[model samples]
Target: MGWHIEGTYFENCNCDSICPCATSGLTAPADYERCQVELAFHVDTGEINGIQVGGLTVCLIGDAPQQMSDGGWKIGVLMDAAASPEQAEALGSVFGGQAGGPMAGLAPLIGEMVGMESHEINYSDDGRRHRIQVGDAVNVDVEDFVSPLDPTELGVRVSGIGFPADTLAAGTGTTATVDVFGMEWDNAGKNSFSAPFAWAA
Candidate 1:
């Protein structure tokens, strides 16, 4: 009944430079006067209800009205197709906020559960860049930004209130797309970042 997970996560949103959601738990108006984003997680090591979830990938695509802190989010979830039925269910529980963990903290913000499904999720990280594809529903490619002060260093470190307290600001090399579960958006050259995250409950 207990669980713990640690991994790397990245997201692309319509917000400019810095997303307000990271700092204010509320997103500022973007191109659509709303916040649309796609988040992907690669689990390096994890377990839930005795189920091993290492090496699995999960994605969330959603949109929020006005401000994220105001809630009213319409979201959908996608799990890796390679996951077994049990693993899928366990993932659903945790992501659905039923199992209680880091995700539980954001459950209240969700206004609608569009759906959940298993898909062919491909995730790759090569030190500098992160790429993800969920069947034909989503595609994202991003890379860490070179520090202005230190070109050799990738990304500028920052602290915020989210799954990962510490994060590296990143930039998208290509446009990201999401077309699934009635949520459609194209976030090209927008805000993005990545961080190592750990959660337990």
Candidate 2:
């Protein structure tokens, strides 16, 4: 059995300017030497082990100690409530790094799996702005940067070491709040961005 997923992805972390997690493979020291963050994904189309996963949403909320690559991330996962039992299990395996795929690359970075649950997930994108909500666990809003030279155009496109490598739109978090997995943080106006992504295994 194999799987492939492609869609939109974004994240909000309590970091300044560029987030080191993307470049250094480890998160830089944040307000308290830890990176509290929320990552969301909207699967426009996907499947795992023959299960359809299109149009579902998922989220990861947690914190990284010291550097992300140092491997001590305590996190929880939230899947769309609309997913059936089988779909939910498939999503859990994929995102939890148990199914071996693009997500397997991230398996080593997670030190603990605090929890996993199905929740009402809301996600939307209106060209320049993106919004995501995972039940009452997380909420985030981000707006793309407008080109300084040409306000009519979008901001710079970023390319780097992960999914959505070339289509990232640089942006700032208008609001980021999370309360789950024994972690609590608010990173309003922090580092955030959105992009289209594709992954397979």
Q: What are the TM-scores, per candidate, against the unseen true structure?
A: 0.92, 0.92
Backbone clash pairs for candidate 1 read: none
lDDT for 28 in candidate 2 is 45
True-structure RMSD, every candidate = 1.8, 1.9
1-201 per-residue lDDT for model 1 (tens digits) = 789888888889887766666755554444457888888888899999899999999998888876677888998999899999999998888878889987788899899999988999999988668889998899888776776789667566556566654555656646688899988878878888787788788
Tens digit of per-residue lDDT, candidate 2, span 1-201: 889888888888888645666654444445448888888889999988999999998898877875666788888998899999999998888888889876777888788899987889999988678899887878899887777798668676667656435457777889888887788888888888788888777
Candidate 1 regions with alpha-carbon error over 4 angstroms? 27-32
Local distance difference test scores for all models: 0.81, 0.81
Residue 103 shift from truth in candidate 2, angstroms: 1.6
